[model samples]
Target: MNSARCILSENDCKIFQTITDEWHNSINIEECFLTWESKSKCKAQSKTSFLHTLCFHIRGLGLRWGEVLLLTLNGKFDVITLLETGKFCKSTITNAFPDYNIFYQKGGNPHGGVLILIKQYIRVSRIQRDV
Candidate 1:
C-alpha cells in the first residue's frame, strides 16, 4: 500500500513539474515580447529565423480581421495573440487566415476572450485545463 502511494505521489510530482516548466516557458516568451515591444515601439520589423510573435488587444476580431491580416503580412509574424476578441466563429477566422492554426478561449463575459494563431508550418498543441 505504501509503495502504491509513493508511486502515485511520484507521478503527481512529475506531472506538476511538466506544468511548471511549460509555465516558465510561457513567462519567458511574454518577457521577450515585452522587451521587444518596448525597444521597437510596435514597429513592423521581421525577425530572422526562429519565431516572431506579436500580440494585440483587438477588442473584437470580427471588426479588425483586415487590420490584423495586414500586420501579419507586414511584420511577418509566426505567432499572433489577440485579446478581448469577444465571441469567435472558428470558421470565420480560419477562412480569413488559412495560413494559421487557430486556438481560442471564450470568456464568461461577452466582451472578453483570447485568440491565438500560429503559423501552419509551426507545430503546436492546445493545452486543456479543467475548471
Candidate 2:
C-alpha cells in the first residue's frame, strides 16, 4: 500500500503542532468567551423595541450577518431556553460574510451556527417567488 505524504510550511507545521499539543485546551475556551449580555454595546444598529429585541440579542452575541438574518421566532425562543439553562452552542465560522450593515446579500456555505438562520431567509424568499 502506498501512503500519501502531507506537506506543510514551517509556520503551518508549527500551528498544527500547537493545536495537537493543546487538544484538550477546549475546556478552557468557554470561560474566555465574552458573554454578550455582559457587554453594553456593539457597533451594529440597535432597535430597542420589543419586536426588535430578538435581533438585538443575536447581534449582541457577535453572530455574523448571515446568521442573524436567518434567525427565526423559534430560533429566538431557543436562544432564550439555552440562556435559562446556562448552555449555549459553540460558534463556528461559515463561508458567507455579511456587509457592514449585517445583511446577507447572497452566496456562501452555511457554518453550523449560521445554518438555521440562513434557512429561515431562504424559505421566505422561496415562498415569495412562488406566489
Candidate 3:
C-alpha cells in the first residue's frame, strides 16, 4: 500500500490517496480521494445514509424559556437539556412542553436548576439520584 497527500486549492484542503496491490500484483486504486469536486457530493450522499438527531443544551431557561421553546420547535430537537432554569415549581416547567416528557432536578439555590426534555414518541427511562 502507498499513500500520498494532494492539496486541492488556495484554501489548502488536503485529500489523501491510497494505492493497493491485488493478489495478482496488479495495482488497483479505489476512489479513496475526496477531491474538491466530490466533497459536496460526498456530504449530500452521507446525509441520506445517516440518521439526523438534534440535541440542544441551553444555559439559561428562566426568562427565556419561551424563546428556547421556539428554537427547539423550529429545530425539531430530539432531546433538550436545560441548566439554570431559575424555576422551582415542577408544573411550570412541565407546562412548557406538554408534548414532551420532562425530568427536572432543582438546585439548592433559587437561580440554579436542571431539566431534561425528550419527545413523547421516543422511548426513554429516567434514573433518579440524590446528590
Candidate 4:
C-alpha cells in the first residue's frame, strides 16, 4: 500500500533525474504538446484542438484565453486578429468551427468575469480557495 505522507528522498530525485534526462535532450515541440495532452487527460480531441488554438493565439498575439473564448460573433473581426492584421471582416468566432463552446460570465452575477477551460483537471487548491 502507498502512504500519503511519503517524503521524496534524494534517491527519489536521482531516479526522477535519470528518467527526465532520457527525454530532456530529444523532446520537440510536437512531442512536448503530446506529453502535455497525455498528462492532462484531455481525451476529447476537440478540447485538445481548442487548447492548441488558444495557446497559439495567446502566444502569437498575447491575448487572454477568456478574451478569445468570449468573443462575440456579431463583431466585425476578432480583436486579436484585427489588432494583428489591421483588417476587419465578419468574425470567425462562430463560423468555420462550432464544435467548441465558449465560456463566459452572465449578467446579474456576483462574480463578473469569463471562465476559460485551459486544462482538463482542476487543482485541489482551486477548489479550496473557492470554498
lDDT of 3 by residue, 12-129 (tens): 3332221222223433223334333376788888887432344444455666767776877687666777777765456876776788888777777766777777778889888876
**Superposed Cα deviation of residue 21, candidate 1 (Å):** 40
lDDT of 1 by residue, 1-131 (tens): 34545666877767666655555675587775666566565454444347799999987877887888798778978889999898767887888779998888887787689998899999889989998
Candidate 3 residue spans exceeding 4 A from truth: 1-60
Instruction: List residue ranges in candidate 4 displaced over 4 A.
Output: 1-8, 11-15, 25-27, 42-131
Model 1 Cα shift for residue 57 (angstroms): 0.5
The number of the candidate with the highest lDDT is 1
In candidate 4, how many Å is residue 47 off? 19
Cα miss at 131, model 3 (Å)?
4.4
List all candidate RMSDs to the true structure: 15.7, 19.8, 10.5, 14.8
Cα distance off (Å), candidate 2, residue 64: 50
Candidate lDDT values, in order: 0.79, 0.33, 0.61, 0.38
- Clash pairs, candidate 3, are none
Q: In candidate 2, what are the lDDT values of residues 69-115, reduced to their tens digit? A: 46532343321110111112333223332211122322232321222
Return whichever of 1 and 2 wins on lDDT: 1
Candidate 4: residue pairs that collide: none
Candidate with the greatest TM-score versus the true structure: 1
Residue 17, candidate 3: how far off, in angstroms?
A: 36
